[model samples]
Target chain A: MSDLTLTPNIDGADDYYAELLAMHDGLSREESDALNARLVLVLSNHIGNRTVLSQALAAAALKPIK
Target chain B: MNQIFETPMYAYSRHADQDATTPPRHKVIVVGAGPVGLAAAIDLAQQGIEVVVIDDNDRVSTGSRAICFAKRPLEILDRLGCSAPMIDKGVLWNTGKVFFDKRQVYDFNLQEEGGHAFPAFINLQQYYLEKFLVDRVRELQAEGAPIDIRGRNKVSAVGTHPNHVTIEIDTPEGSYNLEADWLIACDGANSPLRAMLGKDFVGRVFEDNFLIADVVMEADFPSERWFWFDPPFNKGQSALLHKQPDGVWRIDLQLGWDIDKDHEKKPENVIPRLKAMLGDDVEFELEWVSIYTFQCRRMEQFRHNRVIFAGDAAHQVSPFGARGANSGLQDTDNLCWKLKLVINGDAPESLLDSYNTERVWGADENIQNSSRSTDFITPKSGMSRVLRDAVLDLSEKFEFARPLVNSGRLSVPCTYDGSPLNSADALDGPDRSRPGSACPDAPLTEGFLLPKLAGKFTLLTIDADAPDVIEEDGITVTRLALSLKNDPTLALKNRYLGEATSGVYLIRPDQHVAARRPSFDDKLFRAAIRRATGKE
Candidate 1:
C-alpha cells in the first residue's frame, strides 16, 4: 500500500506560503522562476518513491484546465 | 610564466590645446575609445556629426576580453565597415556540445536555418575587433569624416548642464577642458564618469569567481564550444573551452567563492590546472590569465540629460552568454540612429527616451539570462543544486528536458517586443518580420537586405511595386523592393510575407522592423515611420 495521502499534510500551509512569498519579496521575475522550479524539484526528491511520486503528479493534474 | 600581450601604441597623449583648431564645443564627445565608443563615433560620423573620443589608455584591450561575437553584432560591425576582417580572423562555431561529468548531455546547433550572410557565432579576440574598428574609424577620418580619437586623455571631472556637458580631461601633456552638446560614457564597467554622476549599478554580485586563461597551442580541436559541469578533470565545478583565432584556446575554469585570485592566476598554478584538463601531451603556452567575479548589474537609465551611456558603462553581465560586448554593440546601433535623428532635427529630442527605455529592457533581459546561466552552472543553495543536477541528468535521456538545460543561452538580438514605438500590426504578416524585431537578413540578387537598407527609414515591399521615397515632416523614407525573382529560395518572401501573403514593412535606420502591413497603404506606412521616429 502506498502512503501518499494527497491531502494537506502541513499544519500551517498558509504560513509556509506567506513565508515563501516573503522570501521572494525582492527577487526578480527570473529569480522567482528559478526558485519555483527548484522548490518543486527539491520537494519532489524529498518525497522520493516512484509510486508515490506518480500518484502526486497525477493528483496535481486533476484540477480543471485553467 | 607571465606573458603580457604586446599592444601597439596608436596615438600618444598630446596637449589638448595643442590643436589650434580646437572648437569650443563639439556635436558629441565620446569618452573611452573602446569598441563601443569607436563604433558610436563611426555611426555619428556617418550622420555627418563631429565626434571627439578620448581614452585613458593608448592601446586596445590587453587580453582577449570578449571572444564570442554574435551575428547581430557582426551585422552592425558590417555597417561600420569592419566585419570582414573579424569573420576572416574569427573561428566560426555554430554548434555547442554540453557535458555532465564524463557524459555528453546535450548538443545544440544554430545553423539549422541558413542562407543568411554571417555565421551564428564567431570567436575572435576583442583586441582584433577593436583594432579593426579603429582602423575603419581612421580610414573614414582620412576620407574627411569628423571623428577624432585621442588616447591617454582621461576625463577627470564631468559637469552636466541642461543643454551641454563640460568635461575636464587630464592628458600626458597637460589638462584641458572641452565641451560637448551631448556626451556618451563608454568608459566600461568601472566607469569614473558613472561614479562622478553618482549613479549606482544596482544588481546582484555573484559570490563565485572564474579563473580565465587564454593558452596558445596548435591543437587539432574542432571549431565548437565545449562546456562541462562537474567534468572529471575539474570535479564538482564547471569548465568552458572555446577556440580563438591565432591558435589560442580560451579556457574558463570556475573557482568557488573565497578564492585567492592572485594565487590561482599565477602561471605555475594555472599551468598545472591547464595540464589537469588538457593532458601534458599537448604543448601549450600560457598567454594570459586573470580571475574575474561576474556581476549582473546596470544603471536604471542609460540616458542622463546631455550625457548618455552605452556599453559596459551602462550595463554589465557575466561572460557566460557572451551578451556583454554583443549587447553593447547593439546599444551603439540603437543609440546612434536616434541621436543622429535628434541632432539633425529630423526626430524630436523625446526620441532619446526610447533609447533609455529600450536599452533598459535589453539590459534586464541580458541580466536575467546571465544570472540564470550563472545560477545553473553554480547553483545558489542545496535545493537549487539538486534541481540543476536533475535538469542536467534528464537532459541526456529526454528531448523535452533538453530545452530546460541552460548552458549559457547564447546571445541573440533583443526584440523590442511591447515597445510603444511599434505601429501595431493590423495585417497578418510573417511572424519572422514582426514589428519591433530586428528584421531577418536575406540574400537578395545583389548582396543582402541589411546592406541594401543602409542607414535610412525603408519601406520594404515584397511582391509589389514600391512607392517612391516619401519625404515629409523632416523624415525621408526610402522604398526598397524584393520579389520572387530576386530571391530564388523564397526565403525573403517566406520571412517577410507570410500567411495572408505580400506585405510592406516599415524598417528603421538601424534595420529594426518598425511596423508591417499586408496591404500597400501609403498613409499607414508613413504614420508608422512617424511613430518610429518619435513624432507622436
Candidate 2:
C-alpha cells in the first residue's frame, strides 16, 4: 500500500514552480541536469519508503498516447 | 500639458533670515518642498511645531509622475486635512486587467473591505499632489500656524552637532547660515543631504529602463488598470496602461537594458511606439514623455542624530508597485507624531529609534515586493522566463494560478508586526486588527471609526468600560467608547471583537495597534502606554 496523496497538495503552487525554475538560473544545462538528479536523490532519501518512492516515480513518468 | 506645473507657486522671495546678522535657529527645518517634504512640514505644523520647508525649485514637478496614490496614504492625507482636493481630482480605480501575449489572462478587483473613508487607489499627477499640499500649507499659514516655505532656497552644506544641526542655505540674493534643532531630509532620490552626510543607499539597482508617455486624449476606455505581458505591440516586454484625471492616460512600456535612453524619449521615436500600442486611428496628443530607470535602495538608517531622512531621501523603489511616494507619505505619518512627542518632552528620544526600526522594516517589505514584481515582469534568465510564462499560461485556466500573477502587488499599509512599540496582544480579535497592525476601519452608528480616532493615542474600547482619559508618563490616551448596541451592522464588533465578547485596543497616534486586550486593565494599559511612548 502507498500513502501518497497527489491531488494538488501545495499552497502557492505557482510560487513553488517559479522558485524551482529560478533555482536553475545561471546554471549550465549539464549542471541543471545533475542538480535535478541530486535533488531527486535527496528527496528519495527523505522518503525512505520504497512503495511511496515507486508510486511517485510511476506518477511522474511520461504517459503514452492510447 | 497642465499650465499648473509651469506657474511658480513658490517663486523666489527674500526672507528676513537672509539679512539677519546672526543665523536664527529653527525648531525643525525640512529640506525639499515636494509632496513628501511638504507633507512633513504640514504634519509638523499641524501639531503646533514650528517647521520651515526649503526647496531648490519654485514649482511642482513637471511630468505626470507618481500617478497612483493608495488608500492608506489617502487616509493619512485626510488626517493632514488635504485629501479632499486630491480625492476630488484623482481618478478612483480598483479594477485591473492582466494580459499575456494577445489574450487576457484575468482581471482582478482589489476588493476593498468597505467602511473606510478613502478608496482603494487614486490616479493623480504628482504636480497636483504637491500643489494641494502647498495650498494646505498656505491655509495653515493663514491660520497663524508656524510654517514657512522658502522657494529657491537650497541647502548647500550641513553640519551635524550634539544638540542641533547647522546648515548653509543659498538664496537668489546670497547665502546664509541657519540652525535647526532637528533637520528632515526629504530632498528626493538624489538626496543632497544624504550625500553631504557622507552616507549612501545600500541596495539593488535594477538594470532596466521604462518609457512613460502621458497622453492627452478623450477616450472611452474605462477607469481601470490594464497590464500586458508580451503583447503584440511590444514583444517579450511588459506594458502598463492607467487612466489619469483631465483626459490624460499614463502608459509605461518596458525597454530592455542597454538602450539609448535619450534617443528613445524623442517625440519621433515615442510617437511611433504610442501609435503601435494605441492604433494610429486613435487621436491623441503627447502631453509629456520621459524615460526612467529605477533602483530599490535605501539608507541603512533613516535617522542619524539630529538629521532624519524621509521620502525619496530615505528609500526608493521601482515604480511597479506604486510604493515610492506612497511609502514616503507613510514615513512622514510615522515620523511626525513621534517627533512631536519628543520635542514636547512627552516621550524619550529613544522613541525615535522605533521609527527607525519600524520604517526600515517597511522599506524592506516594499523593496522586496516591488523587486519580486520586477523579476516576474522582467525575467533574468531563460528558465525564469519559462517559469513566468508557465504561470501566466496556467493563470488563464486555473483559479489558483491567478494569485501567482504579480502585476505589481500594489502598495498597502505596512503593519509593524514585530515592532518594539507593539505590546503583547491578549485579545482574541481579528488578526487584521492585531497588535502592530494598522487599525482596519469600521463604521460606527454616527460615522466612520478612523476619523473619530483621528491622529492621537487612543484607547478604543468596544463593548467595554474605560475612563474618559488616562494619563501616563506625560502622555494622554483618550477613550473612544463604542457599543455594538448602537451599531446595527455589527461591523465594529466583527472587526474589533471576533471571538472575544469585548475588546480594548490601545492605538498609537499613527493608528497602528500598540497593544490590545479582551478587556481594559488599568495597570496593563499604563504599561502598554509606557512601552508605546518609549518609556519602557
Candidate 3:
C-alpha cells in the first residue's frame, strides 16, 4: 500500500511537517498502515496538492514497518 | 534478614558525562516546552516510556498569558510529582466580583460549594508553571526517567513514515535529524504542524481586539476577579482585572470593533486606556501591552496518520473564559496516557483513534461555549447588542433573570459523552453511568482525597454488594457504602453523579470517567478499560 505526504507552500512549512512526523511516531504498525492507506484520502480531502501527497506516499513506503 | 547496604543517591545517578551523544530515541516527541507539552512528556516518561521534548525558545516567556489554572490540570501535575510547587506558588481565588458601570452587581464565591481538591481556580503566571514543569523534567531525568529535553532547537521538518517519524531540527550549532516512534504537537495556536497536515481550522474570528496589559499596581483593588460588563474606559468596551502574585494585576481591555493596530503598542495610547479603566488616581505603570484577537475555531480532526494535535493547535477559544490553555493541557492529558498504553502494547492500535474522536468532540463543545460567551459579551450587530443590553438591564432587577445574568458557563472541565470508549448500555442510564465525564470529587477520611484514586482505570463501587469486582490489573476498585457528600458549586458533583448508589465508574488517567456501570461486572470493567485505551 502507498502512503501520503503533505507539503504546505506557506511560511513555517518545515515546522509544520516536523510536527506531523512527531505525531506519526506515536502510532502502532497497524494504525500507521491504516493511516498510510487513508493518506491520499485524508490529504486529498484537505489539501489540493496531488504531487505532495504522492511524495508523502512514497516516503511512507520507503520506511519499513518496525 | 541480612541488613542491606543503603546506596547513596549519588551512586544511583546517571552521570551526564557518559556520552550525551547517543541519547536513546524516545517513543514520542513532544514539541513546545510549555505546561501542556511538558505535562504530556512527564506523564509518558513516568510510565517507563521514553520521551523527547524540543523547543525553539531557550527560556520561558515571562508574559502572563494564562494566569488561571483549573483543578484538573493541578491533578495531572500532581501525577508528575510537580503539583506541590505549583499549589504553593499560585493564588487560589474562590470568589469573583462582577461590575456594571463600575458598580458591583453580584459577588459569587466559588468555594461556597467545596467538594474539589482545589478551589474553582488558581491564579499563577504561565512562566512559573513552565518553570515548575522544567524543574520536574530535570528531576525525573536525574532519577533515570526516560525524558530528554532539548531547548533552543526548533523543529525544522517532519517526515512521517509507516513505521517512524524523522524530525529535522535547527539548533544553534546546525541542523540535525532525530527519529521518533510517534509525535504529539502541543504547540500553540499558530501550530506549524497542523497547517502541513492540511487540516482546515474553521470558525468565527471576532472583530473586536483586546489590549492585555500586565502591571504592578499599588491600588485598593481587592484580591478578587473583577469584570466590567460595559465600561466607559474605551466606551462600549469590557475590562477585566485579575490579581496576580506579588501585587501584580493583569488587565484586559476590549478596544472596540476597530482601532489602529499599530497604535496599541505605543505606551502613550495604552496608558490613557489603563488610566480610564483603573481611574486616574490609581498609580500603575504599563509593564507590557499588546493587542489580542479572539478566534473560536477547531481543527476538523485532532489526528491524521501518526501525528496528533493538542492544545491550541487543535482548537482556539475566546479568552472571555480562561479556556484556551486549560483545554489544551486537558487535551495533552487525554492523549498522552492513551499513547503510553498503545506504545507499551497494553492496548491495541485502535485505541489511538479515540484521541481524535474524544478530543475533536470536546473541541467542538469548547468552541460552541466560548463562541456563545463571545456573542453574549460582544454582539456583532446593533440588534444583538441591544438585546444583550436589555438582558443585562433586566438581570439587575428581576430575580428570575439571575441565571441569564450569571452566565452559568465557566471554564470547568468538559465530559466526553458519546465517545466510542463509553459503554453502549451505560449511555441510556443516568448521567453518572456515562463515560467521558469528569470523576466526581468526594471527601474521604484520613485526609485522603477521592479524585486521587482516579488517574488510572478505577472501579468505584458505592457498596460491598460488588466486593469481588476488584481486579489486580491497572484498575483500582474503591468500595464505599454510599456516595460521599459533595459541594454544590462543583460541576462534577452537580452535573455528573447526583447522589448515585451502587454503581461502577471507570476513570481515565486524565481524570475523566471513561465508563460506568450500574453493577460491577468483570466483562464491563475490561470493556471499559479496553474502550478507554482504544483497544476495543
Candidate with top TM-score is 2
Q: Across residues B177-280, which tens digit of lDDT does each residue of candidate 1 receive?
A: 88899999999999999999998798899998889988888678887888999999888889999999888999999989877888998898899888888888
Model 2 misplacement above 4 A: A1-22, A33-66
lDDT of 3 by residue, B356-401 (tens): 8878877877776676667667766554454456556544544333
The candidate 3 chain B region of ten consecutive residues with least summed lDDT is B1-10
Q: List iRMS (one decimal) for every candidate.
A: 12.7, 5.2, 25.8
How much lDDT does each candidate structure score? Answer: 0.83, 0.89, 0.68
Report how far residue B433 has shifted in candidate 2, in Å.
1.0
CA deviation > 4 Å runs, candidate 3: A1-66, B1-25, B102-104, B406-408, B425-433, B465-501
Ranking by TM-score: 2, 1, 3
TM-score per prediction, in order, is 0.88, 0.93, 0.79
lDDT of 2 by residue, A1-66 (tens): 556454445686545755786789789877877887898999899988888887667544422111
Give the Cα error of residue B196 in candidate 3, in Å: 3.3
Q: Candidate 2, residues B453-493: lDDT per residue as tens digits?
A: 77899999888999999999899999999888856677788
Model 1 - which docking category?
A: incorrect
lDDT of 1: 0.83
Cα error, candidate 3, residue B136 (Å): 1.3
